[model samples]
Target: MILKRFFQRSQSPARSCYEAIVAAARHPRLYADWGVPDTLDGRFDMITLHTYLVLERLKGEEPEFRQAVVDEFFRDMDRSLREMGVGDLSVGKKVRKMAESFYGRIAAYDAALAAPGDGLAAALARNVFPDEEGGPDIAGVRRLAEFVLTQRARLAAQPVRAIAGGDVRFEEPGP
Candidate 1:
């Protein structure tokens, strides 16, 4: 049973998609040029944002495929918490909180993207930049918002077959 599960995980398309999402979220330019914080919360927000974009694009593709990807994301979060020395008993609670945060972010981004004007940028500022001494970096927040919109369009252009085949690409972020 254990080996079967391991092999399935290794071979899953969902795994590949999750990896691509993580790679995109971890792009150095996001932190350096776009001004996303390099801290744990910042990284989490980035990953969550990227995941939302992919999952949004995956709509109507296949319910199972989306569920698999979501499962992989939660599994990674659980693993990360464990590695960070979170107690096993506490892991579930933290993962739950993470889920709540993820869903809230998804809702925020969805609403913002669907709205006109500076909604998206405002959401990005609130979530990506969070609290700052004077205020969040407006230029950086705008840049990041632009990057997110561009990625959304790029993902939309990708063939569903290609995405289902575990092949996905994200354009590099720039200064």
Candidate 2:
């Protein structure tokens, strides 16, 4: 009871937003037949993409809340690593690497979104299909990029209270 109260009291407003992002990213349709590899890196990339969207949505809000969400994200990453049997020391290093990778992704994705033409697809192909044998699936990259743009617009339209309360929802990879 004491522990529950302690945790409940400390919960961030962005907790639900994070949970919503993870839930959508983990949707089986993203992997089962969508061409996303069912491997660890694939999963990480998807999660990072979704999380980055949420962070971008938070950009116009209080800086502290955005930082809180980011901090909470790393905490969740640390917990996930431990749950997956990573040793404590290695977990820190791995999470550090993940953070660096995510920041890089953020820059690439932001640039792609800002640039003209098929830059978003190109960025997705490079990041999400980095290990594909013949090369990235152009169709799949295009579809994923479409979804990102759609979802970003939807996220931006959501009331801040709804997002903060974790009631966010996303359309699938199509209209």
Candidate 3:
């Protein structure tokens, strides 16, 4: 009993943060008010942005905890793929694709954030806006880029204890 109590591991906090990020990404303002297309690709882009922000904020933490969060993120992705009917045989390939996409976006978002004068906006446009239709929604992309930066700042300001305890909160979107 003492061992169990001493070594208790609570996964809820991390999972809750994951859930919160997803819900925030799924907010309707992103789709309706901000004009992020309410399509699969659009949704994926939003989630990726949120995930990237979280991962960035997690920098400098204990490696194990950070990796635990990443593992959970991929576990969620795998489950989502299965639920969405990605075949068992193809799931690996799809996950590989997802990981590649995640890594690429991380690099891209890092560069965009570090860049000046609408760099992040341009990156957002390139990723979230479909090429087959209208050109990037520059205005909406601007808002989302700002949103990403704002969230990144807020997350950095949070204490690792609070974050690990699932006490994270995202700033509300602007009008």
TM-score of each candidate structure, all chains considered together = 0.93, 0.89, 0.87
**Tens-digit lDDT track for model 2 on 3-86?**
887677654577876777778888787777568887888988998899888878777775676676677778888999999999
Q: Is candidate 1 or candidate 2 better by TM-score?
A: 1
Q: Which ten residues in a row have the lowest lDDT in candidate 2?
A: 166-175
Q: Locate the minimum summed-lDDT window of 10 residues in model 1.
A: 2-11
The backbone clash count of each candidate, in order, is 0, 0, 0
The residue ranges of model 2 lying beyond 4 angstroms of the native Cα positions read 1-11
RMSD of every prediction: 3.1, 2.5, 3.8
- Alpha-carbon local distance difference test for all models: 0.90, 0.82, 0.81
Model 3 misplaced stretches (Cα beyond 4 Å):
1-10
lDDT of 1 by residue, 1-175 (tens): 8788877745689889999999999999889877789999999999999999888998888678888888999999999999999999999999999999999999999999888999999998888888777878899988888898899999999998888778888888877
Clashing pairs in 3: none
Which ten-residue region of model 3 has the weakest summed lDDT?
61-70
**Best-fitting candidate, scored by lDDT:** 1
